[model samples]
Target: MEAALDAGADMVGLMFFPKSPRHVSLSQACKLADMARGKAEIVAVTVNMDLDGLSRINELVAPDTFQFHGSESPEACAAVKVMQGTKIMKAVAVSEKADLEEAQYYAIVADRILFDAKPPQGSDLPGGNGVSFDWTLLKDLDLKKPYMLSGGLNVANVAEAIRLSGARAVDVSSAVERERGVKDNDLIRAFIAAAKNA
Candidate 1:
């Protein structure tokens, strides 16, 4: 978290999904959130979690945003926004042009939209798989709300990804890690510099 903040990240994500290697406990999330609260937006990332679970997180973490990376409908996203009074960033997995259609629906309910690569087959996790889709698919995207590009971004290719997708914002995960689930500060800094320079 400190590395990202030092690297001038606009947001920092705390994973709440148990199945994900990146998952953090409520206590851990609280500490990280505290560290990043004022410096950067604290985003609580979850899969198809229930409201009760989300409420518990909200009460403890007080995240600035809730990033829903699941099969949540627009109504579900809207409900969470009203319930928590926090911004929502809904992830839309894209493997093809047809996948982008879902972002249009989420745009109405979510404060921001995130375009991520679809999880590989047999993968239990929703994202953070180090997989990438066709960035060109988003070149012509037009939406009322702001959107972010994510999935497979790294120090080596983030600039190209941004240029090709025309993404104003981007998110990274496994690419900045030294190993699965472990973040490397140097990689984080390098990736941020690359993205910013792009």
Candidate 2:
């Protein structure tokens, strides 16, 4: 959070999914966002949200960035981006080369694309699974704009991920946690340190 920002994280995220252990109540997330706002870009991570839902979140935390981590259509993302008046980073799961194809549809619509691991079909949660794919899968491929590499990233391998994938921006949720959802400040610092050096 504040520590990660001090370590040079341009942005920090707060999860809002009820099903996720990382989920935060409005007041809880608001406080965290308030603390991290001036230091770093605050991002509210949501999944399959409607306009009204998005409005509620937009008003509550007022995150500088919004990350849609679900199976949202290009039109849906575009509409949200326009409605929120904020930059939107649409999260897409990438496992194979074909997975990169979906990035094309969002190239013009989204402010950025977040490549994460594909969730299992029956999994209740969307992301934060700590599942990673081969970095070689993304080597040398370009889609323009800024992009984020987000699946299973941590202090241990973030440098390698950046070197192999050529992603300037990266995100993490589960990897910084000590338990399933409890974020560890130490891990967060270590991750940012590793990423900066990368």
Candidate 3:
């Protein structure tokens, strides 16, 4: 979290899904959220958590945005926005052009959309699989809502990924890690620099 903030990240995501390797405890999230409060937009990334769980996270982290990375319906997303009064970002898993269509359903309820690679079959995790979809599938995307590109982004390919997909924002995970769940500061800096330069 500190590394990304120091690297001038516009937003920082704190995972709250236990199944994900990147998940953080409530206390850890609180500290990280506090650290990023004024420096960058703090996003709380969750799966299909219930309202009670969401409330707990909101009370502790007070994130500026809640990113839903699960099978949350448009109504569910709207409910969260109304109940929490925080911006919403809905992640759509893209494998083909047809998958991009899902973003339209969320456009009305979500403040932004995040296009991520579809999770591999048999994988328990929903994202951070180091898999990237065909970027050209988004060459003519028009969701109206601001959208971000994510999935398999690294310093080596981020610039091209941004160019190919015409993405104004992006997200990275495994690429900046020394190991599965551990982030490396230098890689974080390098990736941010590369993306910014692009």
Estimated TM-score for each candidate: 0.99, 0.95, 0.99
Off by over 4 Å in 1: none
* Tens-digit lDDT string for candidate 3 (1-198): 888999999999999989888999999999999999999999999999999999999887899999999999999999999999899999999999889878999998999999999999998888899999999888878888899999999999999999999999999999999999999999999999999999
User: 146 in model 2: Cα distance from truth in Å?
Assistant: 0.7
Clashing pairs in 3: none
Error of 3 at 9 (Å): 0.3
Please provide, for model 2 over 13-103, each residue's C-alpha lDDT reduced to its tens digit, 9 standing for 90 to 100: 8887889988889999889998897889998999897789888889988998889998899998899888889889999898899999999
Task: Tell me how far candidate 2 lies from the true structure as C-alpha RMSD in angstroms.
Answer: 1.3
On a 0 to 1 TM-score scale, where does candidate 2 land against the true structure?
0.95
What overall lDDT goes with each candidate model? 0.95, 0.87, 0.94
Backbone atom clashes (below 3 Å) for every candidate: 0, 0, 0
TM-score of 1: 0.99
Q: In model 1, how large is the Cα lDDT of residue 93?
A: 95
In candidate 1, residue 20 scores what lDDT?
Answer: 87
lDDT of 3 at 78: 99
lDDT of 1 at 140: 71
Output the lDDT of residue 192, model 3.
98
